[model samples]
Target: MATKGRRALRLLGAPHITVACLLWFGVLTVWGTLYQADPLHGLHGAVQRFFHSWFFLAGGVVPLPGVQGTSALFLANLFASMLTRFERPSRAIGLWIVHVGLVVLFLGGLLSRQYGRETTLVLADGEKASMSVSETGWEIAVLTPGAEGRREVRAYDVRNLRAGGSLAVPGVPGSVGVVRVIYAAVVSPAAGLTPSPEQVTDAPAASDPRMDRPAVVLRAGDERLVLLGEGPAAVLHLEGGGEAHLLLRRARLPLPVSVKLIDFEKKFHPNSGIARSFSSRVEVDSGGRAREVTISMNRPYRHGAFTFFQSSYMDNPRGPEVSIFAVSENHARLLPYAATLIMFAGMAVHYLPRRRRT
Candidate 1:
C-alpha cells in the first residue's frame, strides 16, 4: 500500500513540477545562446513573446508582493522538490549549486544594471578635467562663470559636438554653424613624406582663406566661435543664460579621483610577431591617497572594492599604448563561486566510479 501511494505521488508531481522545471531550463538556454547573435531576428522574438505571455500568466497566478523573486523562487522550489522526491543526493547537490549560481548571476546583473556607473576620461597631453563623464553615453555639462569673472571654462554634451550639425542653446535665437570636417593626408612633418595627390586635389582654394588646422565653427546668433585642434581648448559660446551645456557620448570616470597613464609597455615574442604581454603603469589618486599600480593582460589591480583589468590597446606614432582596465565592482560575486564549486563536486561524484566488493 505504501509503495503504491509513493508511486502515485511521483506520477502526480512528475508532469506539472518536473516538466515545468525542464521547460524553464531549456527555454533559458536557448534564449541565452541566440539572443546575442541576432537579437531582433525571428526565433528571438518568438521566444520573448512566449516568455512574456507565460510571465503574465505567472503574475496572475502568483500575485505581486508574493512574487518578488518569482523566477528564482520557482527554480529553487523545483530543485528542492526533485531532490526530495528522487532521493538522489549527488543530483540534488548539483542542481542546488546550479540554481544558487543562477540566483547569484541574476542578482549580480540586477545590481550592476541598476546601480553600476561607468564613464570615460579624455586627458589631453597635459590637460585634466575636474570630473569624468558617465560611460553609458549621455552627458549634461554645466559651465558656470569662473572666479576670475571671465567665462573661461566651457561645459557641454560631447555627443552634441558632431562633425556637421548646428547646435542651439535654449532661449537663444539662431543656431551654431555646422563646421565642415575634411580628412586629408598632409605631408608627415616628422616622417617627411610628400603629400598625396588626393590631398592636393581636395585642398581648399588659397583664396578662400580657410584655417590651416582642423577646426570646428560655432555660431550662436551674431556670435561666432572657432575651435581648433591645435589650440589649448575648444571654445564653447553661451548666451545670457548661465547654464550652457553640450551633450556628447564619451567614457566617464568617477569624480574626485583621476587616473593618469604614467607609462604603457608592450612585449612581443622575439621571432614571431605575436604579442606575449602588455602592461600599463598608472597613478590613481583618491581623496589625497595616491597609489601607483601596474595592470597586465589577465592580472587585475584591485583597490578598495573596485577592480581594474587590462582590456584593450592602440598604436600611435609615439608607441603602442594599451588601454588598461575595465573596472567593475559587485557585492554578490561570491555566490557564483560557491555555486560553481558545489556543481563541480556533485558532478564529479555522480560520474566517477566507486570500488565494489564481490
Candidate 2:
C-alpha cells in the first residue's frame, strides 16, 4: 500500500516539474534575443515571474527526508548509488567529472560577479596621472603644491564632453570647454545638411563637423558664438555670456602613476608593406620606482598590481605613436580555466579509448 501511494505521487509530480522546466527554457530563449532592443520589455519580466512561480511549486511538490531541496540532493546521491551498484563504470566517471566541472564553473561565476574591477587610463601626449578610475570613468587629479603655495589635489570626473556644454570646476568661477562628441550619422556639414528620418521637432540644429576639415560654431546661452578648431583652447565672443572668466579645457582623468611617452616606434616588413610590429617606449613612475618599458602588441608590462598592454595605436604622417594598457582584475578567474581543463581531459580520455577499442 505505501509503495503504491509513493508511486502515485511521483506520477503526479513529474509532469509539473517537466512543464516548469520547459517554461523556464522558453523564457530564457525569448529574453536573450530581445534584451538588447528593449531591456525592460515584458518578456524579461515574464521570465522572472515564471522562475519565481515554478521554484515555489518545485519546493512544495518535492518531498524531503529532512529539509526542502535536500530531496534533490538525495535523488542525486541515489542515482550515483544506482550507477555504482549496476557496475556502470564509464557512465559514473563521466557524470562525476561533468557535475564537478559544473559546480566549479558556477562558483567561479559567482566570485567574478561579486568582485571584478576593470579600468581604463588615458595619458596625454606627455602627461601623468596619480590615480586610476575604471568603472565610474572618473580620474582623480592630484595637485601637489608648487614652491610658493599649497593647493589641494582636485578630483575631476571627466567623460566625453559636448562642444558647447559647460563644466563646473570647484573654487573656480564659470565653466570649462569639454570635448564635443559628434555622432557620425547625426552630423553633417551645413552646406550638405539633410533632415534625418528619426529627427524629432526638439532636435538641435547643427552641422556635422568632419575630422577631415573640421570647424565648429558653438553657441553659449541664448547669444554668443565660439569658433573652435582642433586645438586645446577656443575663444568665445558673447554679448551676455558673462565675462568669459573660465577658459575651455578638455576633459581628462588623472592616473595614480605618471607616464611619459619617451618615444614611439612603428616597423614594417622590408619587402612587403605589411606592418610587422608597433610599440611604445614609455617612462612610468609609481611608488618612487621609475622605469622605462616597451609595450608591444601582445606583450604587457606588470607593475605592482597593474598590467599594462599595448591596446591601440594612432598613426600620422609625422610619426606613429601607440597607446598602452587595458587593465582588469577579477579575483575569481581561475575557476573557468580549471573547468576547461577538466572538460578537455574528459573528452581526451573518452575519445582516445573509444578509438583504441574500435
Candidate 3:
C-alpha cells in the first residue's frame, strides 16, 4: 500500500499529467466552440453535455473528458505538484507566483460553478416586478382561478422535458403528457382559419424567432389540450365554474426589492440608427420604502444579495420599451479581483529585484 501511494504521488507530480490536462482543456474549448456553431446544438446544449459532465460522447462515438472532470484532475495535479515537486525554496519565485495565480483562478471557477445564480428581469414602461425569471429553467403551472382575482397555483418542474414525457399535475385529476413542444415557435393566424391560441402550425422551418411563441400539447384524461405558452388558449374551463390555466413559463425567484420602471431613454448614433445607449429610470421598493434610481449600460444596481445589470432592450416600436436586466447573485463575485491583485503583487515582488541586478 505504501509503494502504491508513492507511485500515485509520483505519477500525479509528473510533468506529463499537466501537459495532458492543458491539451485536454484546449480540446474541450475547441469542441465546445465547434459544437455551438451547429444550428440545432446551441451554447446551452454544449454547456450541459460538455462543460457540466464528467464524460461525453464526441461525434456520438468517441469519448472525451468534460470541463468538470478535466478541471478537477488539473487542480489535483497542481496541488500534488505543489506538495511533492515544488518543495525547494530555491525554485523561481516567478514560477511559484504563477502557480498560485493559476490555482486561484481554478478555485474561482469552482466557486462560480457552485454559487453563481443568474436570471433575467424584464420590465416594460410603467411596469413593476418583484421577481426575476430564469432563462433556462422551465416550469408548468396548474392554476385554478378562484373568485375575483384569486388563484391557487401548483407548479411542476419540466426543464428540457422532451416529447412523450409525462408528469402529474398536482391538485388536478389526471396526469399530463407532452405530445409536442417547440422551444421557439412562431404563431400567426392562417388565412380562412379561425384564429385561436391553441391553433398551431407545423414545426417551424428554422429558428427564425419573429413571433417568438412556444406551442405545446398536453394530454389529460383522454383529452389532448393544445396549449400555447402564456397565449390566449392557456385557460381551460372545468366541468364546473372555475377555470384551469396551464401555463409554461420560466421558474421564478422572488426578490426582496420590487422595481417599477418609470421611464426609458434610448439614443441612436448619427446616421447609423444603432442604439448608442439605453437607460431605465426605476423606482425601487424595499422594506416598505421607495427610492428612485437609474440603471444604464455599465451601471448596475446592487441590492441585498443580487446585482442587476442593464443587459439588453426589446424595442416594441409602437408599444412601450421593454427593458431586460441581467440579475446575478454570486457569493464569490470579488474573488477574481482579489486573485488578480495577488498575481500583480507576486509579479512585482519577483521581477523588481532581478531588474535591479541588471
lDDT of the candidates, in the order given: 0.49, 0.47, 0.76
Worst 10 residues of 1 by lDDT: 205-214
Better of 1 and 2 by lDDT: 1
Regions of candidate 3 where Cα sits further than 4 Å from its true position? 30-53, 86-101, 145-149, 160-244, 341-358
> What lDDT tens digits, residue by residue, belong to model 1 across residues 283-311?
77787787887878887766554566776
Q: Write down the worst ten-residue block by lDDT for model 3.
A: 204-213
Tens digits of per-residue lDDT, candidate 2, 191-254, equal 2332222221222322211122222233344433322222233333334332222222222334
Per the 3 Å backbone cut-off, how many clashing residue pairs does candidate 1 have? 18
lDDT by residue for model 3 (1-358), tens: 9888877887886889999999988888898888878878667767777787878887789987898888888888877776677677465566567668777878887777767878999999999999898766556777876658888777766546678887654445655788877666555656122234355666643322223455667777767766555554355556656668787777787788999999989899999979999999999999889999999998999986689999989979899989999998877777777778778877887788889989
Q: Number of clashing residue pairs in every model?
A: 18, 12, 0
Clashes of 2: 12
Superior candidate under lDDT, 1 versus 3: 3
Question: Scored by Cα lDDT, where does model 2 land?
Answer: 0.47
Q: How close is candidate 1 to the true structure, as a TM-score?
A: 0.47
Which candidate number maximizes lDDT? 3
